[model samples]
Structure formats: structure tokens, C-alpha cells
Target chain A: AQSVTQPDIHITVSEGASLELRCNYSYGATPYLFWYVQSPGQGLQLLLKYFSGDTLVQGIKGFEAEFKRSQSSFNLRKPSVHWSDAAEYFCAVHLTGATNKLIFGTGTLLAVQP
Target chain B: DVKVTQSSRYLVKRTGEKVFLECVQDMDHENMFWYRQDPGLGLRLIYFSYDVKMKEKGDIPEGYSVSREKKERFSLILESASTNQTSMYLCASSQDSSYNSPLHFGNGTRLTVT
Candidate 1:
């Protein structure tokens, strides 16, 4: 079965520091990877996605993710963390089949400290 | 911009009662999905519809049913609500099943079954 794993359950980073969130996936085929962020009491917003193009994908709010095929990982990175960046981040893999569903990882919650 | 709207922000229901959760998408998307968000379980798909009057079971569809009578609306039904069903239900839509198409999510409905 295909699965996604986010090892870090919670992380606290000082404001203005760099941030990196780890994500790993297991799938048979070339995976379509995505990263989404959810704020408290709000819906999730797309952060970035990795398709068939370059290994590095850029997303909204100054976020980027690198898809490493050998490692089967897609890690999200931001140069500088802002206070507003405190949220839950989820990594997902799109499965192509009869249903074409997405499998998500247990999210990583980021708490930015001032 | 695509907009996915969930009918309720919060709901409380009694056990064994039938429950209905409504979702509407303004973009006339070809795919609509229902998922439950829980602590430590990022998001688990309940049901998804690819077209009008068509539905498919997802990863976790044991206690849920879905209806997609129209192109813009999809409804999730819980035949017998239970305390275990208390969760944050999210509705999402996508233009198509393309590998790159991103999902647009609605502000979730927090359902609490007592």
C-alpha cells in the first residue's frame, strides 16, 4: 500500500530562522507529490507540488520543495520563517488509478517563537 | 479563484442520529472529495465523486456515504452518527484527475457527536 510519513510531529523555530519539514512517501510509480499548509480553523492551502519537471518546485508564500527520487522524499523548505508561518504542514502523494485519490501524511505542526 | 464551500462550520449531533454534511464548489470541478482530519491522522479520505451521480469509496469510508446529484454539490451522509465519527470534515474539489491538478479545499466543518 502507498503511504506518506512525516516524522516530525511538532517543531518550534525562532522567527526569522530557516525552516525545513521532512516528508517521505512509498509508491510503486513516479509519485505526484504535494505540500499543503493549514491554519487553525481554516482550510488547507497549496504550498507546492512536484510533477515531472525540475526536481525543485517553488510554491506560494516563498516556500520551495525538492523532490528526491532515490530517497523517495519531498522536503519543504523556507529560507526565513515568519510568525504567520506557524501552521500544520501536510505532505501528500497522488495515486493514479480508478479513483485517483491522494494519500496524506501525519502532519507536522510548526510553532514559531518570537 | 476556485471556491469550495462547506455548509457548516461546526455541528453537534447525538449518537445513532442520521447526519448530513453538504459541500458546494463554484468551479464546476470534475472531482469532489470528502475527508476527515484528525489529530495524528492528517487527512483520511472518506468518499469522492468524479462526475454527477457517480461516487467511489476512499481509504476510510466505513461509516460514510456520499451523494453527488449535481455537478456543483456533493453531500456526505452518516447513516448512524457515533462518537467515533466526531471529526473535522473537509470538502475538496479538483478540475480533473490530471496528475498536476491541485485540490481546492473548503473551510472544514467540525462535527462533534455526543
Candidate 2:
């Protein structure tokens, strides 16, 4: 079975400041990792995905994440976060095979201050 | 862009009532999934359908059943509404069976059972 853990329950960041959200996973093989963002009263949107090739993957809305095999982590980062970036972020993992079910972590709520 | 649509944005049901949640996707994707989101628990998969009339149980499928009579529509049914089952219901769809494919989600339905 695959599982993901997001340590931080909530994080606050000032606008135009760098932001980082940590995520860790436990899987036997290389996992398909994804970052999703959900605004208040809205559905989740895919921010980015990491499969195999690149360790550093860029995503929409000026977000990026690094897939670290040694740490079993895929942490999301943004150089300068905007006020609109305040949302709940989730890290998900999928097995490296035909199964498409995704196991998600306890989301981290991000609050941006101007 | 893929568009997944859930029928309701909010619903209030009484205990022991039969609840129905409907979802539809415009991308004609082969896979559709139903998930429930709670405060400390991210998104727990209730059920998923790989194809029309082919439904599979997910991690929390004990109280939920699903119907996928057509390719683009999937319906989740709750036999008896419970207070504990009150949560945000999310619907998602993926392009294919590939593990790397990302999911497109609907705006979610917040259900309250009283």
C-alpha cells in the first residue's frame, strides 16, 4: 500500500516571499507524484506532476516541486508567492503501474499575507 | 482543458435518507472517481469506475455505491446518510489508465447530514 504524509497542517507566508510546503511518501517503487491546489469554495486544480525523468518539475501559477528519491519527498516551492496563492495544497502519490488510484496526504492550508 | 462537473455545490440531508451525488466529465475519460474530504483527512476515495458499469471499491467504500451507465457520467449513492458521512464530496476523472495521468476534479459538493 502507498501513503503520503504532509507534516505541516497550516503555513503562513508573506506576499512576494518564498514559500515551501513539505511532503513525504512511502512506496516500494518509484511513485507518480502530483501537487494540487484548492482555493476556498472551489475544487482542486492540478499544479504539477512528476513521473520519472526530471527531479525538478515546474508547474502552473509559478509553482515547482522537487522529487527527492532519497528522502521519499516531493516538496512544493514558489520563489515569490502572490496573495491569490493562498489555498490548501495536497500531495498525492500513485503506484508505478496500471492502477490509477491516488493516495493523498492531509492537506496543508497556506495563508498569504500582504 | 478537461471539465469534470458535480451536480451540487451544497446539500442537506436527514439521517437515514438515501443520498445521490451525480458527476459528469466532458473529456470522455474512461476513469471516474468519487472521493470525500474531511478536515484532518485529505481525500479518501469512495469508489471508482474504470469503464461503463465497471465499478471498483476504494478505501472507504463501506457506505457508498456507484453507478456508471454512460462513459461521461458517474453517480455515487449513499444507502443511508449518517452524521459521520457529512463531508465535501469530490468527483474526478482521468484520461486513461496510465498511472502518470493527472486527474481533473469538480468543484465538490458539501453535504451536511443532520
Candidate 3:
């Protein structure tokens, strides 16, 4: 069984400030990790994913996440957040051979201040 | 671009009503999934279909059923709607069950049970 944990439930950041959303996962083998963003009244959009590659992966909207095996984390980061970045973000993990069953974290609500 | 469409954006139903949530994928993906998103619980997989007419239970499948009669269509059914089951339902599709493929999601259907 695989599971994901997001330490922060809510985070507030001012516009032009750097932001980071923490995510950790527990899986037996090399896991497929993904970040998704959901704005108000909308479905989730894929931010980025890490299968097997460079630890630092870039995604849409100038977001990036680093897969740290030693820390068991894949935290999403942005150099500077915009007011439109206010949304709920989720981190998910999937085992190698599973039928695309993703184990998702509780999610972190990001509030960007103007 | 891959597009997954959910039939309803908002639904109101009474208890004991049978609710059908429809999903369709424009891409010729072989795997489709249904999930429910609740506050404090990011997303829980309700069911997934790997191929036409083949459905598999996900992490949270109790009180929910699904139908995959065709390759492009997948339906999530609530046998008896309950208040606790009221949540935002999301539909997703991926190219295949392979680990490398990412998922595309629909806008979601917010169901309210009263």
C-alpha cells in the first residue's frame, strides 16, 4: 500500500514571494509522483510529474518540484507567486506496476495575497 | 490535446436516489478513473476501468458502482445517495495503465445530497 502526506493544510504568501508546498510519500519502489493544482470551481490540472529523471522537474505556470529520495519528498516550489496562484494543490504517488491507482495527499490550500 | 468531460457541473439529489455521473474522453485512452474530492481529503479513487466493460474497485468503492460499456465512456453510479456521499466528483483518463503516462481530468461534478 502506498500513501502520501502533505504537511501543510493552508499557506499564505504575498505576491512576488517565493512559495514551497511540501509533499512526502511512502512507497516500496521507485514511485511516480505528480503535482496537481485546482482553482476554485474547477477541475484539477496537472502541474508536474516525476517518473525517473532529474530530481528537479519543471512544470506549467513556472512551478517546479524536486524529487529527493533521501528526504522522501517531492516539494513544489515557485520563485515568485502571483495573485492568480491561489488554489489547492495536491501531491500524488503511484507504484510502478499498479493499474494507475494514485494515492493522493490531503492537499494544501495556497492563498496568494495581492 | 486530451479532453475529459464530465456531464454535470452541479447536481442536487435527495437521499435514496440513484445518481449517475457520466464521463467521456475524447482521447483514445485505455484507462479511465473516477474520484471524489472532499475537504481535508484531497482525492479518493472510487473506481477505474482499464478497458471496455471491465471495472475495478479503487480505494474507496463502498456504496459506489461504475459502468464502462464503451471505450470512451465511463459512468459512476451511486446506488443510494447519502449525505456523506455529497462531494465533488472528478473523472480522469490516461493513455494506459503504464506508469509513465500522466492523467487528464475533467472539470468535475459537484453533487449535493439532501
Q: Which candidate is the best by lDDT?
A: 1
The 10-residue segment of model 2 chain B with minimum total lDDT is B95-104
Backbone clashes for every candidate come to 0, 0, 0
lDDT at B76, model 2? 96
- Model 2 clash pairs are none
Residue-by-residue lDDT tens digits, candidate 1, A13-103? 9999999999999999989999999998899999988888799999999999999999999999999999999999999999986555899
Q: What lDDT tens digits, residue by residue, belong to model 1 across residues B64-114?
A: 999999999999999999999999999999999887788999999999999
For candidate 1, give the lDDT of residue A50.
88
Least accurate stretch of 10 residues (summed lDDT) in model 3 chain A?
A: A94-103
Who is ahead in DockQ, 2 or 3? 3
Compared with the true structure, all predictions reach lDDT values of 0.95, 0.94, 0.94
Please state the error at residue B53 of candidate 2 in Å: 0.3
Interface RMSD (Cα, Å) for model 1: 1.2
Candidate 2 segments exceeding 4 Å error? none
Candidate 3 residue runs with Cα over 4 Å from true position: none
